[model samples]
Target chain A: MTTFQELRLDGVRRRFGGKDALTGLSLTIRRGEFIALLGPSGCGKSTALNCLAGLLPLTDGSIWQDGSRLDTLPPERRGFGMVFQSYALFPHLSVRKNISFGLQMRRLPRDEVRRRTDEAIKLVRLEEHARKLPGQLSGGQQQRVAIARAVVLEPSLVLMDEPLSNLDAKLRLEMRTEIRRLHQSLGLTTVYVTHDQEEALSLADRLVVLRDGRVEQIGTPEELHNRPANAHVADFMGYRNLLPMKVKAVHGDTVALDGSGLTLEGTPVGPVAPGDDVVAGIRPEDLRAGPHGVPVTVEVVEYQGRELAIEARTAEGVALFLRATERPSPGDRITVTADPSRVLVFP
Target chain B: MTATLPDRDTSSTRVARRHRLAERGIDRQLLLLAPALICVLALFVYPFAYGIGLSFQPAEGGVFGAYRAFFTDAYQRDTIATTLGLALPAAILNVAASVPIAYRMRGRFRGKRVLTTILVVPITLGTVLTAEGLLNYLGPTGWFNRTLMTIGLTDEPVRLTNNYWGVFFSLVITGFPFAFLLILSYLSGIDPTLDRAAATLGAGWWQRFHRITLPLLAPGLATTFCLTFVLAFSVFPSAVLVGDPAGTTRVISIAAYHAAYEVYDYPLGSAIAVIMGLVELAVVAVVLGLRSLLYTGSTGGKG
Candidate 1:
C-alpha cells in the first residue's frame, strides 16, 4: 500500500451571488486523519467540503494534494468519494450494482468488480440485502449501502456531509461507531461536516470549530472541550454559564471578578487586564452546590434519570444552569460553586 | 309517560332501520351513477357492439364476409402496413428526440416558461389546423422549400407536401409536445442529488444519464410512445389534406372512411375499425408488458 501524503486547503474563499459563504478558510488534512468540521447551519462547513471535493468552484485560493493542484479539477476528475446528506443511493439499482457502479465506470474487469463489490457488501454487513433495491431497505440499510458504494471505490479522501443527520438517535449512534471503525480499518483520510458537537467530539481526531464561515478554534476534542478560545466557542462546547464580569484585580493566572455580586476568582485563559470586561464561562458539570459559593434561586429543575439539571438565577440576575445528582425544588435557594481552574475567563 | 316511552321506542327503531339502510347503500350508489352509466352505454358501448354486429353481417361471402374481403383485397390489406409504417416511425422519432430536449429543459433558466409554451403550441393547434398549416408551410412553393432553393442548398423547390414526408412531419409536430411533456415530468420527478451521487462515484455525464436517468425513465417513455403512436395512427385529416390519400399516405382511417361513406359499405368499414382497434390493443399490450420488464418503480430520495 502506498503511503498517502497530505491535502491542504490554502486560504479558500467562496461567494454565492454577493454573499460570502466561506472567507479565507485554510486547513491541513494529513494522511489517515479524521477531521470534523463542526459548526452551526450556514456556517460554511458544507461549502468548504464541497470546495475540497471540487463539487463547487472556489472563488479564490486552491486545494493541493502532495504537490499537485486538485481544486482546478472537476468533481469526477478529483477521484474523491462523497456521501451526501440524503444518502443519494440509486433507487433503481440493486445494492451490489450500486456498490459496483464506480468500478464499472472505471471500466474495471468484471471479475475484479464482482470481487470488490462482494467485499464491500460484507464490510457494511449488508450481505443479506445485496440484491435489494434501496427503496425496499430500511433507512439504516440504505445508508450502509451508500457507505459501501463510496468506499468500494477506495478513493484517497472520503467526504461526508451530515451523513447521520437523517437517522434516528439509536441508528445515529450505531452508524457513528461504524464510520469510525471503517475509517480505522481502511486507513482512509476523512473530512466530515456536521452541526452536531457531540458527534464531532466523539468521532474526530481533531475538531475545527467554525462560526460565520471563519475558523474560531481548531484543536483536539479534549482541548476544545477544556479550553475554548472565546465565549462563543465555549458556549458551543457546552459551557452553560457565561457571566459578563468586570475584572477587579489580577494576580498571575488568577483574576478577580466584580459586578457579578460575588468575590469569585477565575483563571484567565486569554489576555486580560485590570478593569477590563471579561466573560467568565463554566460548564454545567463543573458547577457544584457547596457551602462556600454564591447564592442562587433555583428557577427550574429538570429530571434526567441519573442526574438533574438545575436552572438558577444569581443575585445579580445572571441566569445559569448546573447539573446535580440530587433533586432540588424550583424556587429553592442554593449555593453553586465552580473551581477556579475549571472557570475560563476571556476578554 | 308510559305512552310516550312506547312511541319513542318505535321512532328509535325506525331511525335504526334508516341507519341500516344507509350502511347498505350499494344499490343507491349504483342508482346515483346511472346517468354516467347510461351515457357510456349509449355513446360508447352501444355503438361498439353495433359496429361489431354490423361487421359480422353476411355479404357476398358469409358470416365472415367483410373481414374475408378486406384480407383478400390488396388496397385494404396494405393500409394496415402503411398506417403502421408511418405511425411507428413518427412515434419513435418523437419520443427519442424528446428525451434529450426534455433532459436539457428539466432545470430552470431564462425563458424556460416561454420555451415550454412554444413547444405545446402544436398540440393546441389540433389535427385540422396542423394539417392546414403544414399544407402551406411544406408546399412546393412554400417558405420551407423556397428557403432551401434561395440558400443554394437545392437547385429546385423540394417536394415536401402531399407525400409520406408531409404526413410524417405533421404527426411529429403534434406528437412531439405530448412526448416532451411526459418526459419532462419524469425527469423533474427524479431527485437531482442522484446524479450528483453518481458523479462522485466516478461516472461522467453520459454514464450518469445512461445508467441512472434512462433506466428510471423507461416506464414513462414506453407509455408516451404508445400514446403518440395512437395519435399518429389515426391521422385522417393530415392524410387527406397534406398527404397523398390515394397513394403513399392512404392510412387505415381514410380507407375506413371511403368504405363507409364513398362505397356505402358500412359492414366493411366496421370490420376495418375492429381490425384497427385489435392492432392498437396488441401494440399497447406489448408496450405495457415491456414497461413492466424495464420499470423498477422509482429509485431515488423522496422529493
Candidate 2:
C-alpha cells in the first residue's frame, strides 16, 4: 500500500517584530497519522500549529493539502478542528449546543445535527451532562466537551495546543490514553503541541523534537529514546549523564573518548575527529553495576519504587548515574558500566 | 487564688465584652456612612416624597384627579405617545449603531486612540451643549444643509431644526457615545479565544457574531438601551431648543415645566413628574425581565 501525503508545510516562517518565532519550518504529514510538536516554551511549537490552522499567516512559504494551496485560505474556510489550552468552551452554551455548533454552521438538517450531536456526546461519555453549561462541569469534563465539539465536525485534521496541560497529573495520563484511543478509532489526522516530553513520547506515533524554532529530530519514541541524533536531543530524551571529553581516536563508525582519567568508546552520532572536544551522553537506566567499565564511589542513593538511582563520582571527579534494582549505601565503591552502543557521542 | 471560680459568670462577662466590641465596630461603620445617608435623604428622598405628596393634594381636583385628567385630556395624553415615539427609536438606533462601531474598535490599531477621543467628545458635551450645537449645525442655513444643497442632493435647504427630527437627531448625537462606551466595555470583557475557537469550528464572521457575540452582549445592550431611553425621554432643554415647543414636541417634561413655572400649577407638575418616574421604572422592569428570559447568569468562565 502506498501512503499519500495529506498536508505539507514548506519552509513556513513567522516573524514577530524583530524576532522570528518560526524560521523556515517544514514538515509533511500523512493521512491518519498522529504527530506531536514537542519543545519547551518559546520553541515555536504553538506557532507552527497556528500557522497550519491558518490562524496566523506565514511570513513566507506555502502550505499545500492534497496538492492545493491552503496557506491563502482563511481559518474558517480551512474546516479544521482545534482544541485550545483553556478548552475555550462556550460557557453560555450547553454541552450539546457546543458540540453541534459546527454542524449548525454548515446548515445541516436539524435531525442530522441532533443525531450527530448525540453520537458525539456519547463518544465523549458526556451524555449525563449534555444540557449543563461548561461552568458546571469539572476541568476534565470540559475537555471532553471540547473534544466532542471538535470531533463532531469530522474535520480533515485536528489541531490541539497543550490540551492536557491544564489538567492534573492523573487526568493528563487518562486523557493521553483517551486521545490515543480516539485517534485509533476515528483514524483522524492529528497535530498535537505539547511541552511535556513524556506526553509526546507516549501519545505520538512520531515525535518531532523542536528547539529554538528548529527541528532537532523526528522519529518514533523508541528510536529517538535509544538513539538521539545529537547531545541536545539526547539530553531532552532523559539522558541526564553528560560528560565533556576530548576525542582520543576515531574509528570508522565509533570514537574513543578520554577525559577525567576515564577512557571509553562509543558510536559517534555526529561528526567527530581525533583531538576534537565532544559531549558524551548516557541514560541512567543503561548504566549498571558491572565489572567491565569505569570505577566510581557511590555518594547518594535515591529509592524510586521500581528501581534505585545511585549517584556516584569517579576517581577523576566525573559524575555518573547508575540504576539498580537493589539500593546501594553511600561510600560504597562500585564499577559502573554502559554498553558502547547505548552511549552517544556528539561533536 | 485558691478560691472556687464560677465559670458561668466569667463566660457571660466575656461574651458581653465581645458583644460590646462588635457594637462599637458597627457604630463606627454607621458613623462613616452618615454623611452620604444624610445627603441622599435630604436631596433625593425628601424631594421625591414631597413631590408625591404634592401630586395627591386637592388643588389638582382630588387624589387621582390629575392622573385622570392626564389620561382624559387629548393634548396631554398625546404627549406620552409623542415622547415615546421619539425616545424609543432614538434609543434603539443609538444602541444598534454603536454595536458595529464598538465591535470594530475593540481591537487596537494606529488611530484607535484618536478615534476613541473623537467618539467620546459628544458625551462630554452635555445635553444642553449638544442641543445648542445641533441647532447651529442642522439649521436651514447651517453647513449640513448648505453642503447638501451645494452637492445638489436637495434643491432646497432641508427643514432639520425646530421640528421632531431636530430633537431626535440631538438625542442620538448625545446618547450614542454613552451607548458606545458601555457596549465597548462589555465586548472587551468577553474572552476573544471563544471567537477564535468558533472560527476554527467553521463559523463565518457573521455567524460568529450572531451566535456567540450577540447572545453574550444581549444583556448589556438591553441595559444600555434602557438607560439611553430614559435619558432621551426626560427631554427639556433639547426639546425647547430644537423642537417646536408649542406644537410638535411638547414632551411630558415641557408640559410639567409649563404647568409649574408658567401656570403656577405645582400639583399638576408634580403629578406629571410622578407619572414619568413610574413609566421609566415600568420600562426598566420590562426590559430587565426580557433580558432574563433571553439569557441566564453570566456565561463568561469563572471570573
Error of 1 at B190 (Å): 1.7
The per-model DockQ list reads 0.65, 0.62
Q: For candidate 1, lDDT tens digit of each residue in B154-199?
A: 9987888899999999999999999999889888888888888888
Which has the greatest lDDT?
Answer: 1
* Clash pairs, model 1 backbone: A91-B299
**lDDT value, residue B233 of candidate 1:** 86
Clashing pairs in 2: none
The Cα error of candidate 2 at residue A255, in Å, is 3.9
What tens-digit string does per-residue lDDT give for candidate 2 at B1-303?
335467777888998987898877744466888899999999999999999998888474679887777778888878888888888999999999999999998776889888988998998888888888888898998999999999999999899889999999999989899999898888887778888899998898999999998898899899999999999899888899999888899898998888789988888888888888888888889999999877655655333
Among all windows of ten consecutive residues in candidate 1 chain A, which has the lowest summed lDDT? A1-10
Measured with DockQ on alpha carbons, how good is candidate 2?
A: 0.62
